[model samples]
Target: MEVVVSQTAFNRIRCCVFDAYGTLFDVHSAVGVYREELGDRADQVSQLWRTKQLEYTWLRSLMKKHADFWKVTREALEYAFTVAGVTNPELFEKLMEAYLKLECYPDVRATLLTLKEKNFKTAILSNGSPMMLDSAVKNSQLYSLLDAILSVENVGVFKPHPSVYRLAEKEFDLYPNQILFLSSNAWDVCGAAAYGLKVAWVNRFQQPPENLPFQADVEIQSLNELPELLNIK
Candidate 1:
């Protein structure tokens, strides 16, 4: 699947920031928890839920209507259920709660620990609300590993917005070039790279190259390989 392709080395990167959802936590796992009740439409609902969530964010940004990730997520799930013609209050609430404690990917902990040990600042810059980000990080036992958990809500907008990217700069007081942004979302990679951060596209699912103005500085299929690319042994 053309997994590993290295371009630039560490190059004075001080902080390694990550995208939270698909990049570290398994977003689809939210639906996985209810697969039995969801039946044959489990995959469809999950896929639609993610798609709608992102679409709502972008749409809200363009429309100048801001809603936190939690609300956006719930609305997205509601839309998915409506489309699937399924209605179950208990299952719905459970699915929403599942996201707060989404299953983390296996490679995440070790990667963060390795970066922490190497003395590199690690953080999550996500479209998630502060509470959502905190829950996921703490639930995954990764809160202690991070130097910062930056949320777009602080800026009152979703990502790909120029203001959203500036949070990292303000938080770390580091120049854009000094930070390396990693995201499984190709569009997010484009956004951060366009905003001038050194970016590594964590292409977890071997998705095709994004048709966007900017591309990743490095690409890897797994987060486990990030340490190697940064020249850590």
Candidate 2:
């Protein structure tokens, strides 16, 4: 469903924080590069990898078993390969390396440039480890565009956690409402919103929202729509 939220909901925001994985970087692009090798099961492997990666984070968080996202990613990929009946070591190694340079969405650079020009403090708060997030950012040539790249590794916990949300406030020294958070994951949106950050769910896939207690202030199809929603030029 298309969300028609009021633009006024975003007028008071000062800082802009993003979720890195499915939001800024195209996560499935790893499998995309190896589609020829994987053949018909490429899509299934990619989707399952992503789905299990998220489930592991939440499960680990709930279980108080903290592991860096790099480990979780590898574990998830192994399971995905097993389910898809893919067993090539070289292909596995290739896909893993490909993740370090996942494709940047076309809308990202332009939107970040607009934010930088307008002086909005932009950063990424992701479940990825600092090494992983930094590697992806630099690989995608976004090092200069972001003010910071936050990782759950800092707090030893993942999303929807109050402490992880607190990392942004500590970095920018601003209250949650003053920071406008953007995420493609509905669950991440719920996490930031429930933490009191003004949030915009980047509904890139037009997927339905999660059945969570919190909801985003608005939903946009792309970051290109952000400046208009924020009343920026």
Candidate 3:
């Protein structure tokens, strides 16, 4: 759990592109808001919702039947509700609204501010829809901190896909080595690294690294440590 950096990493990085959900924003915060309504099944529903959400994304990607993240999110919610056997229209609506305004992780603001001050171009490359990302960024007051919000909607596919990573390169007009891709999702770290981007895995939950072909250039427990790891200051 301390920040781990490769000696050669970050030297050529000119941009830091982050994953939105789970990396910058807390994905479970939506369910947390409706905990009282779901009672004992709160945690179960939350976990299942997140699991199904990601599963659907990958499944859709493989099937070549792409859907926007918001659609996937709602579909996942419906499945979670069915599995949890608790369905209240009001509760469902509340959870959906909560997601639009999901709370940013505590370290996000300061880390992004640091990256901005250091003259690094920061952006969000996410599976979220543009409307969803816009709401969360505005709600978190991070709209001005980021240079771009790159959504998978643009390519009609989910991440861990090379095309998704290419959006950042195209938007920033930078090569893979000049971009530092950050994500809490280990698979994403591998995916970005496989695509030749330097990656910093923000392992906030202390999860094990993925058994993948590519490894991240750095691993840090929080975004707060990213500045130091990248030698930004």
Residue 4, model 1: lDDT of 53
lDDT on C-alpha atoms for all candidate structures: 0.91, 0.92, 0.91
Tell me model 3's lDDT, rounded to 2 decimals.
Answer: 0.91
- Candidate 1, residue 119: lDDT: 95
Better of 1 and 2 by TM-score: 2
lDDT of candidate 1? 0.91
- Ten consecutive residues with minimal summed lDDT in candidate 2? 1-10
Model 3 quality (TM-score): 0.97
Runs in model 3 deviating more than 4 A are 1-8
Give one digit per residue, the lDDT tens place, for model 2 in 151-219: 988899999898898899999999888899999999999898888888899999999999988998889
TM-score of each: 0.96, 0.97, 0.97
lDDT tens readout by residue for model 3, 1-233: 34455756677889999999999999999988878889999999999999999999999999999999999999999999999998698888889889999999999999999999999999999999999999999999998899999999999889889999999999999999999999999988999999889888889899999887798888888888888777875
Worst 10 residues of 1 by lDDT: 1-10
Worst 10 residues of 3 by lDDT: 1-10
